[model samples]
Target chain A: MRPAEADGGARPVKEVRAFIASRGRAPASLLDRYVAGFGLVMGAAVVGRPIASLLGGLAGATDPSRAGAGTALVLLACAGYLALARAAGPVSVSGGDASWLLLSPLDRRGVLARPARLLLAVAVAAGLLLGLGLAAVLGAPDHLVWRLLAALVVGVSATLGGMALAVLAQASASWQSWVTAGVAVLVVLALVAASGQARPALSAAAHAPPAVLGAAAGAAALACGLLVRRALAALGRIPARALLAASTRAGHVATAAVRLDPGALTWIAEDNHWRARRLRSRRWPSLPGPLALAWQDWLRLARRPGRLALVAGAAALPAVLAQAGAVSATAALGMVGVLAGALAAASSGTAGARRDGDNPSLARLTGVGRGPALAARALLPALLAAAWAAAAFAGLALTGTLPATSWLWGPAVAPALAAGALRMARRGPVDHSMPIIDTPGGAIPTGPLFWALTGLDVALIGCLPAVAALLGGRMGDGSLMAAQALAGVAVLAAYVLRARRAR
Target chain B: MYESIITVTGLTVELGGNPVLTGTRLAVAAGEIVAVVGPNGSGKSTLLRCLAGLQPAGEGTIEVFGAAPSDEGPFWRRVALLADEPAWYPGLTAREHLELMSAVHTGPSRLTVEDALDVFDLRSRADAPPLNLSTGQRQRLALAATLLRPSDLLLLDEPERGLDAAFRERLAGLLDAYAAEGGTVVMATHDPLLAAHGRQVSPATGGVPA
Candidate 1:
């Protein structure tokens, strides 16, 4: 046995004692100990017969095979949540205080261990509660309790595995947070949906034969969780909070040190990595220096996963939906791209305002006049639009709905509305919310311009086919009209300037 | 005493329908780096912002150049701002950023983006994305970019904040040089050293140079 595993696999007391003996650690704080006890007791008793019956009869409800399906579902849920966390862990945890925690006396492993355990226990308890509810509601038969028990156990593995994916992603800064959860759900759901469709017997979740089915799910979950755990360990010490000293890098002159701005940290995260990755000896009959700038944008586009996904969805959806004889994939994709950006832009624009932080002078800077700078400043939402566009297209294609003749008009209309949205974003003492969370009456601060963007987008759709016809892009029907209208918008945007605070 | 180059008339600001900065008139002139001394919520930053064109004045006139803000179209090209908090595009490199800025200008008279990079000792980091640069480096970059602007008027809010003595002294020298070259500078700081170097002080809401 491994020496670390030698102590009875560590009962609560033995674990604490070993830690204290070796490193002079204290027991859990009074609040923590009490919370721990509360959790353990809560788990052990809820699984006790009487409570389980009252809660979900889940413990008493299932046949073994049926229990297996539920076990898979629970694992699926855990995995979903974990992936959500890893993808979008806040860049600034509480605006940068968490980074400071690294310097405290707490060792990283020891510090993370309790929280991870607590999370694990919580996952199991949640699964148990869910299972019990199902049993109570469905009047599950007696043989199913063992299945339920196994399902809960399996859930622990699923939760850890999913969470591990997220943690790894976040630590590596590999992807945007919003997409992380969506991707995880889509993956798990695709599996469950596909399998459930093919074999109805597998989804007879209330029926049960034995605990083996649940146990298999549990094993799969456990393996995935273990993988995530190992990945986190391999990521090494990030020391995210350790401020980069100017000395390590040139141009960090003695004259410019300030409290580490979170913005700077983000810049450092990209800048340092990029520099390290730069080719020491780049040789080429390179493209003209002036045009070379586009390569940077190309690289940026390639790196952004959500953007690619959105593009694929928008492009594919019409074809997919047409095959299924559904709604117009073109209209659907257009709306998706516009609305998502419309919603996301408000929040991002507000964030921009907040970061701008009362510095009205930035408006006065001549650099703000550049088309590209304006574009970059408003990029967060533009990409949101792009993602929406891509997804809409892909969904249409998948559903077989694309109008065969209207294909070429897709790229033209997407960017036309996008350019309009970009224009509106710039023209703000950016009208947004004081409490900018998404809620009733808490959506985008509504006004004239909001309606204008909406109207403009709709108008673009109305004219698409005409514009396509003018360009001779091809269209079988007048329905290609919307592309014509979107094409027309490009002209309006070129002539009309977006308003900003007067200098 | 520093003369007033930026002037605000009947300026008012509100947050969540509550007044944060009232119809407060203020002015700052060329060669003035005023340390806006204040306790935390005293509107020091808000005042700087009115001049910066960040937060809108609920009801007032802010003249940046010889014209009111409503005519600020040309005024923006000449202004450089370093917010109390840094602002950057996460995806763009430092060099790309300069390129973007240069695109807005009608071909600046001097200070190619490369020269500014060399001045700030940022040549090595020129290709580094803004997000990857250290705080000090980013701040220097922001300053260098701000300095490169052709606007005779310079407005820097809390520019010296969070800097060690070495960096702080270097900033003072840069300011002195800018003033010698006939540029207008309006820098806000809380540091006593910055105040002393500027030969003036302003209350959090007060605007007299000294």
Candidate 2:
């Protein structure tokens, strides 16, 4: 055993970290400290007004009709947070630390302490947001301060417990199953809440006395503390190989972020998922050349049934939001959310196009003409976007946010969404050399900005008719739908034709 | 007499103000195999890229199929280039990748997916994703994908990379069989066994036959 392992590893690990830190770059100068402090102050100043306004909005009694949907939304958001935390390897070090320290004979818990603290900080911030959102949604009928505090306590406890559960899941398979079950339960509960079956309970909780609320918060906090203790103990038991794999994934994510290349993140996730999966080879379906080439995307989408179900489930989110009075307040926000969700759904089917764009050796080997291949590729995304947007629109219309015929807008704009998704997939890495223009607020780096807007630009331009009609409450108009369909088809055809001429 | 499939004369490539290949000359005919052997940074891959019309030569004339090579669909239909391992499509098994290759071509594949898996000794792991395979296995999968499709000419860069001695020899025979089927191959190789299977040339010596 190494020397560090002799005396429980903690002291040695600290000494080593300090030694490395001392040998590292100079400490921040006074000016650097000043700038950081000034930035924080300015940020707080900018965020303060909106937060105050939001708090003011939380003063009234909860709207009974909106209570169930609001509660469901809150539950769904928490579930999403937990899932993201689990996926991110809630306990992971930076690439440098992972390389140098992770495999050493230090106390595993000691090595993980910094990352654990970082996770805590992130969880706390997210919990605060969740708390604020809950307070705003459920409303404080009286004694706003005490109710808000209770809500904050409950939110923090829930996220802290969820985060602790995620950490435990990393160390134990049994815990992983529990986390999965928990997320499933949350989703089911959300559906129940959205259906208005939970209104009585939600209404009672919203108007509960401060003493009862405090007791519930106390129970939650106790559970959170126990889970956290278990998680801290479990840290030492996490396998080295698992930690290494998670660290490598985190390194790739960091690299992608540093490069401002969001597209690379999808590939990283894709490759990681497949690397761990066991798959049986299936015979390729007989199809024409370009269609055969495009069939991989279809096969890929079919393979991930859970993801498809999640996408299907998310179609109800717009209606839920509208019922919660969030989307109904802003028509533009509602339309944007629908379009964005459709584009994301479309993007899920464009992995094959993305792979070819990154490295076209397979594409070249296939030897399919670009136009025909692209046209074939567009079919799946267009179909996916069409279905997703239509479902979302139907939900919104049922919620009285849109007209009865509003679902027609979904298919009309789907081709453009598909075109946008394909464009996004093929948009290569961000070019950092693009000019940065100075603005009053800050210097705007056009490189990443343009990279981000590349696909959205096409989608927005193509879906302009739909956007205008939705905003104008003209979804019942037949002419606008016809115009949107024409525009969508034109955009997709133009994109494919241009791609054919490229290279 | 065999028809000439490719001819290059006075080929020069400069990258970032440095010459990688200077005054290179090469000629290949149908059913011929030429191995371009050179040290690292000797522009072997660059020469292959030029042949595929992917790299722009600073000064040279490269004629493939009696026309300047073009990086377009029709040109690729007649030529297959396997340099670095292509990014395998996610969620695809090794056999599935070969199947995709066979499915996407109108012409008959040289080897069926099952035959390729058996020949490449990947039958056991054929159902696994290429990412999960060992480096040599992934290389074999790439080769399977490359050769399974129909092409008149093959450009292979370091085809022996990540292969064991036994597999390398088998690959040499496979290339011979490919050439025997009235196709042309120009590969860059570090393995003497693979190089000796073809007319050995070096980019250092302007790609002249050695």
Candidate 3:
């Protein structure tokens, strides 16, 4: 038995923490506390006006046509929040603490107390935002303050309960299934709301009296309290192995964030996912040399059918936003969103290109010319981007935002998206040596700004015709569509030829 | 009579203003196996990299295949270099990686995918991703991928790393077979047994044949 067990038990958590603190950095000074307080005050001052304006806007009845889509978006956001919480361990420590303190025979509850508090703070903050969104979606017809308070209570309760479920899921297999079921139910509810089937019920709840709202709020708070208590009690029961794995993942994420290298995070996530999976080797098809090298990306995509479905499902988000009156095809924000989504879909298949850009050892072993290899690799990304954009455009047509023929623009713009994805993958690390430009707004570091804009510039230039058509409300312009197709193909072909010349 | 595959005269290299190799001379013929053996930080790997055209020599002349070495696809097509543990293509099994190697090089591979798996002792773990394999198994997979592809010259850095003693002996036999097929090899190694299988040379002695 361990020495701590040999004794009566582990020391009090407070005393252990105190002992550790003594050997660590000096305590925060008065000036440090003052700066922290000032920063918080400044942040609140900056954010307070928009929040108040939003709440003021929520005081009246909402548009009935937008209610369904708004409700669906709110539900989807909650589901996404819960899923992200589960994926993130919802309970993880820093690298130093996990390595030095987690494995020791100390009080496990004490060891995890800090992360638990952090999770709680994050959940609370997210719950507040969710509450505001919910209030906005289901506007108050009477007693606006009381209705808003009830919404806040319900939102906080739901998030706290979901977070508790995630925590329990990490410690036990059965709870994990429950959390999965909960997310699925939320998604189904979102679909039901989006379909307008729940319109009557949503309308009734939006105008409900203060007494009814207060009772519901009280019940939600009681349930949230119970789940929070249970989660707190179960904190010490979490397995060390699970904790270690989660902590290591968090460490990688922290490192990536600190270094401002978002590229590393994708590899970290990919390596971790494959490390746990069991794969069956299949015979490689007899293809040309460069095509053979590119086949790995197709195989990778095929292996993750769930991710494929998720990407397909995400294609409807633009239409959903349009339906909710949040954005329009003619708006800059909406166009940017559609283009960015297509680019992201395309980038999902460019992992092979990214891997080669990061490390050329495997590429060298393959012995394929860079230009041919890149051209071959672009095919999958183009297909993915085309399919995703087509689906999105079809959704927009259904929403009456664009003509039915707009779907043809998807394939027209796919080559440009593929080129952008490939360029983004090969952009390498953020060069911190670039000059920082000062503007009236703020000082912008050109390195990260340039890194962010590298692929986007190419994509924007290639898609200029489509962008112009959309912004000018000329969706039926056949000439612009043909121009988009020509521009995309020309850009991709030029990029490939340039790569050949560069070699 | 043998054709000269590589030649270096009075090659000097410095890193961070420190001399690692100075006035090194070496000559290698086709179908020959030459092992660069030396202690740590003695420029063994540097010489191998220089030969593979990956590292630039600070001064002096170096030639491979009767031309200055270049890092390009055509150069790599004729020369295969296995230095560090390569970043494995994500989501690919060890066996599939070997299959990919065979598919990319239209020329006949030295070993079929199945034969490479068996020869490298990775047959049992063929379906496992390289990330899932132990250090030794991953190293074996790397070696298998390197050897399965067709190349005129093989540059291996620390081929014995993470391999069992038994596997190291097997690696020696594999290298010999590769040479027998008229492929040239220049390797950096610390394993005496592996080095003994070739013409051992040390960078410390200005790359004179030992």
Give the number of the best model, judged by TM-score.
2
lDDT of 3 by residue, A30-116 (tens): 967877887788789889988988888987899776888998998998999999989898788889888888898777887898899
Q: What are the fnat scores of the candidates, in the order listed?
A: 0.24, 0.86, 0.77
Instruction: Please list the residue runs of candidate 3 whose C-alpha ends up more than 4 Å from where it truly belongs after superposition.
Output: A1-12, A26-46, A436-444, A501-503
lDDT by residue for model 1 (A1-503), tens: 75544542334334543655687566579867776787777777766767644645344443333333333443344444555344233111222223333344334444345435554565565555544533443334555556556554554555455455544554554533533664666556534532334234443544555665565766766686676566458333434432122122212321123331223333343445445554221111234322232233444544545645644433433332233222343354443443344334322322232223334333344444333333343344334444454454344444444344333344334444445544433333423333334543224445433534643553345345544443452344555545454454554344233423321
DockQ-best of 1 and 3: 3
In candidate 1, clashing pairs total 98
Candidate 2, residues A294-390: lDDT per residue as tens digits?
9999899999998999898889888998998888724687778899999999999999888899999889988888888899999999999999999
- The better-scoring model by TM-score among 1 and 3 is 3
Tell me each candidate's i-RMS in Å. 7.2, 0.7, 0.5
In candidate 3, what are the lDDT values of residues B43-151, reduced to their tens digit? 9989988988888999989999999898788988999999999999999999999999999998999889989888888889999999989999999999999999999
Please give the range of 10 consecutive residues that has the lowest summed lDDT in model 2 chain A. Answer: A326-335
Q: Write the per-residue lDDT of candidate 1 for residues B1-210, one digit (tens) a residue.
A: 555577787777887887776766666577555456556676777776777666777888887765554324455555666775445543456765565445445645246677878766778987776656787777777777677666666677777755667777877877777777766666667777766766454434444444
Q: Weakest 10 consecutive residues, lDDT, candidate 2 chain B?
A: B201-210
| Runs of candidate 1 exceeding 4 Å displacement | A1-299, A302-363, A367-400, A419-476, A479-503, B1-64, B69-71, B107-110, B131-134, B164-169, B189-209
